[model samples]
Target: MTLGEILAVAAVGISALTLWDSHQERVRTEEKAVATADRADAEAAVLVLRATPSRDGDRLTLAPLNPEQAIQAQTILFPSALKLPPVETTGDPRIEADWFAEPLKRARKGAGQKDEDPGDQRLPIIVVTHYLAGGARHTSRAIHDLGYTLEGRFLRGSAVTLRGMSIVRTVKEEGAQAALDAVWTGRHRSAG
Candidate 1:
């Protein structure tokens, strides 16, 4: 073949190879992007699942604090759980009221124990869970009404890529109020 014709054929082959390489690279990039999106969706699903009630019949209760001593204390009664431990406040202050003993008290009183006045043993605890990447300023500010003092926090995760933060606060009277307000206001950051 003529030299010019040969050179032209070689150029055409190189062009074809280049096009094939570009197509393969594009396919790879697309696959990577899809995989990343799928992973993100999965991470969100996991967060939602974590927020669901993992313990059924797990009663949640709160103890009434001394309104005078407790800042922002109100007459509103709070619920508590029987099987759970005393109020645990690490990140912020919290109150523990004996919710599990009411039924027992009634039963005992019915059995003729009138002196069984369930003592007001309430310790305040404020728990905040942050899913995904978010700042803690709002939560910190909201719990202020609940009398919570930021004590400590830690991250919880089932995998390395995704995790949630568990903020435990110790609530005094005002801190408890703020925490209750947060709950009432639905201030917790949602995935949506």
Candidate 2:
């Protein structure tokens, strides 16, 4: 073939390659944007709940931190070391004395005498909440710390209270049932 013809073909080939590369880059950018949006949506649907101790300090009242994202369903799983069964509820559930009294007693008894820090007496539990936002159901898993301190004038008793609650890393789940199953089976690992 003539030199001019060969040069023309080479230019055309280079132009085609440039167009293909641009198309691939656009596709990648679009995909990334969609993934980011999905992640944001998942986070927005997560419910942050707070635990309040009753007057007697034996029962706990659980409620959502945000009133708008009311809890549709809830489940709480104690640490494997506690060997406690999972608690489930469809409404604002009041945790009776039985649900946590024994555990607190055992934990206080188990506390080492050498340790003087009250923080050492805290217990960790996993809380999974399902809520509806924008007509879609979302599930979130969080870790809450239950704090206990020695109280009383002369009897020297311990009072169980909620220290704080924080959402675990990658808290978003595919669905409510799947998240509950993962937590129950110890498959869900919290980042904090």
All candidates: TM-score: 0.32, 0.54
Question: Tens-digit lDDT track for model 2 on 106-157?
Answer: 5435532322344534455667778876567777676655554434435655
Cα lDDT tens digits for candidate 1, 4-87:
999999999999999999999999999999999787555432221111111321222222122212121212222221123333
Q: Residue 130 deviation, candidate 2, in Å? A: 1.6
What is the lDDT of every predicted structure here? 0.34, 0.61
**Root-mean-square deviation of candidate 2:** 8.8
* Clashes per candidate (backbone, < 3 Å): 37, 0
* Top-TM-score structure, candidate number: 2
Which candidate leads in lDDT?
A: 2
- Candidate 2: C-alpha lDDT: 0.61
- Estimate the TM-score for candidate 1: 0.32
How much is 19 displaced in model 1, in angstroms?
A: 0.2
